[model samples]
Target: MNKKQKKVLTRIIIASVLMIILVLLPLEDYPLVRFILFMVPYFTVGYDILLKAFKGIKNKQVFDENFLMAIATVGAIALGEYTEGVAVMLFYQIGELFQSYAVGKSRRNISQLMDIRPDFANVMVDGVLEQVDPDDVEIGSEIVVQPGEKIPIDGVVIDGNATLDTAALTGESVPRTAKIGDEVISGCINMSGVLTIRTTKEFGESTVSKILDLVENASSKKSKPENFISKFARIYTPVVCYSALALAVIPPVVRLIMGIDPLWTQWVYRALTFLVISCPCALVISIPLTFFAGIGGASRAGVLVKGSNYLDALSRSKIVVMDKTGTLTKGVFEVTKVQAVDISEEELLEMTAMAEAFSNHPISRSLKEAYGKPIDTSLVSDVEEISGHGVKANVSGKVVQVGNEKLMNSIGVQVEDIVEPGTVIHVAIDGKYHGYILISDMLKEHSKEAIIGLKRAGISKTVMLTGDSKKVADLVAADLGLDEVCAELLPGDKVSKVEELLATKTDKEQLIFVGDGINDAPVLSRADIGVAMGALGSDAAIEAADVVLMDDDPSSIVKAIGISKKCMRIVYENIYFAIGIKVACLILGAVGIANMWIAIFADVGVMVLAVLNAIRALSVKKYK
Candidate 1:
């Protein structure tokens, strides 16, 4: 417990002891002394609430639970039910103490998330290490990280090698090896050798800063259920207060009109009980607590949800649309097959590598890597790249055309059909068909499990959308067991395809799109819930996405869905449970069948139970 909770707990204990002492005293002979002793316990247990009630009344906000509790207990005191009034206040304070502790427990997760905030950054100054604020570190500056120190900014390793513990950033316990030229994001702990890194991004624009900002602002975006409870409390409180007033007055007037002696105290007592039952504390506190715990739990699992609204929407998602590259696959291309017609395989590869040596495209890099030798620029001349087709160049005094079938056809070369399930690059020398090189991307180790997990989580369909050829897309879709495939789409076409899918889905069902490329940003924003592979995803895509999987593992998507489902379940359960019990007790209190002790159960007891259930949202690992 926090200091305030401990203090409140102390007050509760003291008030209970005083009440017990008064109950034991001979109070019949000393009625004035008995009243004084009762007031002592009452004021001791509830002085803060009474003061708050008076302050709320002075500020023209007179309908809160504080006011309700103060008036109910004060009315009981005025009716000579001193012990019952003190007990109500004492138990109410106990409930408030429980609420404070529960909220603190939930907020501690967010505080642990904030632990990633760097206290200081080590920058190199004239061969000397200097400690500086992370925010003051400029881009392109060299920062030195020692063993067991957090990387203070996103940067590339320029000097040393080390293993990094990325648990703070990605929740992955496995330590990752980092070497020269590898990019390391901020918030990772350098676990071994010392490293010097050249900062690629300013501290404010770094990954750690963005994630902290995302988590801090999440509570502002409340879910539909939370908003409804907020509105319900606003309208329900005043209406119930007026209704209780009428309950106290109208029934007593009716008794008088019937020529019977009006039992004013009996009717008034029921009104006070009604006021206590109608506090709306359970619904107001538990719904938002459920979502907050879910977000915290997801963060611990390396899924960063931007807000509760997205978390709620994810629970209702039916279809998942995914980008093929980087999301499900390793996204790194490698030469898997080589086909040569007139010349040997080495000859075709060397020619293609010579033609692509001047280009920096991923496919070009794969071809160059396959050759595994540096290109002699003197042997290559007149290099020209045809947009959307291929590259044309003269290598060793021989003209070579290396590209797709479209380039071979345009150059008057009859390209042979290759029924390969990979990206095929056609090679032609001196306008004659040479062959094709098949470069394929490897799938992620967990990609198949991710699809199965999604299906198990109740996702109705899984679809793959990619700019890759139909043959490659279909092969990947079949391998991953996807329900549908959309291939050869540009960035804009992907958006249109998502729109078509959205139109086909039920109105209440959501379509979630996951991607990890700059081109995927548009489609990410277009989907109902956008999940990004943050570790390797582009900054734009990460910014556009609603949720981020920090380790770039596709399986975390299913885990995120599981967390959302659990959270929403808790939210709905609390809503139904609190409202069901409250409505039943309100009716009983209005008819004088329930008294102050029952009122405490209906209000404070219900809130404590709902809060305990809401805390269940933090235990989301089993759901995965």
Candidate 2:
């Protein structure tokens, strides 16, 4: 506990001991002395509440929970119910102490998840390791990360290999292997060996910075139910205060008019009980706490939810639309087959890899990898990119085109159709039909199980959207058992398809669009919920997506949905339970059937129960 909570606990202990001693004393004959003794305990634990109530009244905000509590206890004191008044405030402080401890626990959990923020960078300066602030390090500077140290900036490894503990970012305990020429992001712990890295991004634009920014701004965007409760509290507090006033005065005046005793003290006591029972502490505190805990739990599981509203929408999601490349499949392409008719296989592969080397597309990288040797850039010239077809480059003084069948047809070079399930890249030399190299993208390890998990988790429809060919898309769809497949689409076509799907779904059901987060911005924003998969260091995906999975795992989506559904269930449970108890106690208090003890339970007891239930959102390990 912090110092403040400790002080409150001390006061609660002192006040409770005083109340217990006063109750045991026989001071019935000394009314003045008994009242003075009870005032000590009443003011001790409730002074802060009274001061806050006075400040609220001074600031023209008089109808809050503090004001309700102060008026109820002070009125009971005025009616000579000293023991009950002191007991009410003492119990309320105990509840407040519990709430403070619960909130402290939650903040500590979230802080541990965000502990990946790096403090310093080890820069190689003048042949010596100089520790400097991470923000001062510039791009391309060689920084050394020792074992048990965090990689301060996003960069490429240039010297050593190490096992990286990415659990802080990905929530998965498996260590990732980082070797020479591999890109490593910030916030990962180098567990095994010392490594030298060349910085690729500045500190502000790194993955750690973006993730911290997302989490810090999350609470500013409240959920719909949370907003409703805020508005309800504003109106509910004043209405209850007025009702308590009427309950105190109307019944006594009617009794006098009916020619009987007014029973003013009895009615006034009932009104004080009514005021205590009507305080909206439970609804005001537990609902937001539930959502805060949900966000923290999801972060601990490697899923970043931008706001509570996204969590709400994810719970109602029914249709799941996913991009094929980089979302379901491993976005890496590789050469599966190589066929050459005129030239030797080596010559054809060399010519095609040279022609495609200038492009940074995934297919180009795969072909260059298959070549296994660096290209002499001077041998390739006049590179042209045919929009949807492929590339045409002058390779070794010969016009070579490496693309799909449409590129060969546009060049008037006809080739036999090959029935291959993977992508086929046809090759042509000097406008003559040569051969094709069949390339294919493999599925991620969890892609198939992710589909089944979504179905098991209650998702209705699963679809795949891709720019791949019909044959390739159909093969992947069949392998994964997707309900629908839309292939050979441009970026704009994907948005149009999402819009069409949105039109087909019911308004109550939400639609989710999962993308690679690099090139799917337009579609991501157009869907009901946009999830970016494997978006550890991609800034575009982090900015465009509503939900981001730190690792390249499809099953994280299912877990995310599970967390959201569980959180919303807890939210409704607290809302209904608090309000139901409060209303029932309020009716009974007004009718004089309930007393100050019941009012304390209705206010503080219900709050404690609600808070305990809200804290359940923190531990989500059993979600799987």
Candidate 3:
């Protein structure tokens, strides 16, 4: 508990004990003594609330919760309901204490998840290492990360190798091995060995900074449910207060004018009870707290939801359109089959690796990786890379061509057909077609489980959109049990397809598009809810997305959607329970069927129960 809450609890305990002692004494026989003893507990328990009420009145905020509570309790005391009044004030304070505790707990959870920022870095200056703030380290500086230290910036490794613990960023337990020439992201801990990384991005533009920004500002965007409650409270509080006033005076005035018993005190007491029962405290507090807890829980799992608005939209999503490469698939390619026409497999592999050594394309890297040995660049002469086609080189005094069918056909080399669903690189030696290397991208480990999880989470449709060949897209879709597949689409074509799907959405349905490419930016921005697979995605995708999956796992998407639906359900339950109980008790209180004790239950007791329900949003197992 905070200092203020601790002090309040102390005062409440002391006051309650003093009141109990005085009540057991013979003070009832002395009316003045009894009143003074009663006033002791009343002042002790309710002084803060009275002070807040006065402040609200002075500040022109007279219709606030504190004012309503103070008026109702004081009026109850005037009607000789001392015990009920004191009990009501004390319980209301306790409810406020509970709310403060829940807020503190949620803040702690979010802070722990966002504590991935590194303080300093070891920069190499004139061949000597110097410690400096991460922000002070410039781009292109060589930073040395020791064992057990977090990588301070996004960069490529120039030397050394190590195992990286990426759970802080990705929520994945698997430790990735980083070697020379591989990129290492910020906020990942180096588990073993040392690494010398050449920084390629500034500290402000690093992954950790971007993630922190997204999380810290998540609640600023309002969701529909939260907005509705806010608007309801603003109008409901004033209307109920004025109605309670009318209930107190109108009937008694009419009775007096008609020569009947006024029953002024009875009607006034009922009005006080009505005010206590009608306070909108429960609805105002619980609904937003539920959303805050939901957002915080998602952050702990490395999923950054931009706001509650997107959270609400994600909860209603029925059709989920996903990208294939880098999202459903691992995006890692390998040479699976090699077919030679005129030359052998060994000759084709050697020539392809030599020609691709100068290029940095993933396909080129896969071909070079297939060789699995050091290449003697002396054998590669006159190397030229042709954009959108392939590469040309001179190897061992023979002209070598390594490219696609277009590259071979352009050079008058007859290409043979291959029946694989991947990019085929044609190889020709001295203007003669030798062979082709068939490389395929592998599927992610959890792709199938993610699809199943989505179905279990009540998603009605699953689709895959990709720029890959029709055969490749269909194979992946079938393996994952997807309902629809659209392949070989350019970036603009993907946006048009998404628009058409959006047009078919009903009032109860939402369209969610997931992607991880710069080419997928337009579709990601055009969907009802855009989820970016952040791990391997381009910066453009992240900026245009509503939610970012830090781990790049498709299963996290299902978890996110499930959590959102559970949160929305909890929000509605709190709203209905709070408003329903309060309205029912308000009617009973005005008719004198219920007392001030019951009004206390309607105001504070209901608030505590609703808060407990809101905390359930933080528990993922409850939804699962």
Candidate 4:
């Protein structure tokens, strides 16, 4: 507990004990003495509230709930209902204590998830190691990370190798091996090796810093349910206060005018009970706590939720649109077949690798990998890359063409049709068509399982949107059993498609779009909820998305959706529980059917239970 909570607890305990002692004494025979003792407990337990009420009135915020509570309880004491006034103050304090505890617990959870930021870095300058601020570490500078230390910046390894624990960043327990020439990301711990790295990014642009920024600013985005409570509290508090006042004054005044004994004390006691029961603690505390816990739970699973509003939208998503490359597919090209006519397969691969060595396309990389070693670029001459087609160059004094069917047809080389479910690259040597190489992109390991999980999570439709060809998109969608496929679309086209989908959604349904490419930024922003896959290495994806799946796994989407649904469930549960109890007690208090003890249950006991229910949103099993 914080110091303020401790002080409040101490004051409440001391005041309650004093009130009990005063009540047990022979103070009924001395009405003045009994009244003074009651005033002692009332002032001790409720002085801060009264002070806040007065300050709020002076600041022109007189309609606040604190003002209402203070006036009602103090009015009860004035009418000789001393025990009700003291008990109301004491119970309200207890409710405040529970709220403080819930807030503290939520802070602890968020802090644990956001502890990935490193404080210092070891910068090497003038052949010597020097300690410096993380922000001071520039790009291209060499830094040393010791065992149990966080990687200060994103960089490439220059010297040593180590096993890195990326669980805090990816929620995956598997240790990754890093060696010379390999890339290392920030926010991962170097488990057991002394590693020297050449920084490729500044500290401000590092992964850890970006993740911290996302988690820290998440709460600024309000959810729908939280907004509802804020609006409800604004109108609810003052109305109840005035009604309680009318209940206290109108009945006694009517009885006195009618020549009957005016029972002012009993009616005033009911007004105090009414005030205690109407406190907005339960609704105000539980709604935001639910969202906080949901965001914390998602961060622990490597899913960064930018706001609670997105979580609520994700829970109601009916149509899920996804990108094929980098999202559903493995996004890695592989050499599936080498069809050779005149030359052998090895000769064809060797000649093509030499010609395609200068290209950075995925197909060129796969051809180079087929040769299994770096080629001598000096042997290649007259190199030319055809835009949207392929490359042509002179390898070892012979002209070679490495491209698709369009390039082959443009160069007047006729090749036989090959029926294959993959990309076809035509190759030619010395003015004669040699053969065509067929390559394909593989699907991710968890793509099918994620589709199944989405169906189980109540998603009605699954669609694939990609810039890839119609054939490839259809094959991938069919293999994954998706309901729809939209292919060969540019960034603007994707946005238009999402707009069309949005038009079909009802007020109760939501649409979510998932993508990982820089080109998908438009669509990500256009959708109701944008989920970025493989966001760990992509800066544009992180910036454009509402939620980021750090692990690049499709299965995390299911987990994210499931967690969102569970959080919404908890929020509704708390809302109904709080409102039901408050309404029942309010009616009973106005009719004189309930006392101060029952009013305490409506205020403090219901608040504690609702807060505890909100914390259940942090449980991992809800997703499992």
Q: Pick the candidate with the highest lDDT.
A: 2
lDDT per residue for candidate 4 within 56-134, as digits (tens), equals: 9899887765786687678777877788778878888877887888889788877886678888899877888888999
Candidate 2 residue runs with Cα over 4 Å from true position? 336-418, 425-437, 622-624
Considering TM-score, which of the candidate structures 1 and 4 is the better prediction for this target?
A: 1
Clashing pairs in 2: none
Q: Give the better candidate number (3 or 4) by TM-score.
A: 4
Listed in order, each prediction's TM-score against the native is: 0.92, 0.90, 0.90, 0.91
Q: lDDT tens string, model 3, 1-624?
A: 889989988878877887678767876668777767788888898898999999988998888788888999898878777777777788888888888898788788767766789988998778888889999888998999999898988999999999999876776679999999999889899999999999999999898888888877888999998999989988888898899899999999999999999999999999998998888888898988899898887876767789999889999999999999888987889898998887778878988898888888989899999988899998888998888789889988998888888898899977766656677888888998888888988788888998999899888989899989898788788888999999999888889999989888897799999888456778888999999885432467568899888876778888889889888999999988998899899889988998888898999899989999998887765223
Candidate 4: residue pairs that collide = none
**Each prediction's Cα RMSD?**
2.7, 3.8, 3.2, 3.0
Can you tell me which runs of candidate 4 are displaced by over 4 Å?
125-127, 337-360, 373-402, 406-420, 426-436, 622-624
Model with the higher lDDT, candidate 2 or 3 = 2
Of 3 and 4, the candidate ranking higher by lDDT: 4
Best by TM-score: 1
lDDT of each: 0.89, 0.93, 0.86, 0.88
Model 4 sits at a Cα RMSD from the real structure of: 3.0
User: What TM-score would candidate 4 get against the native?
Assistant: 0.91
What value does the lDDT take at residue 77 in candidate 4? Answer: 77
Query: Model 2, 420-439: lDDT tens per residue?
Result: 76879999999887888988
Model 2 gets an lDDT of 0.93
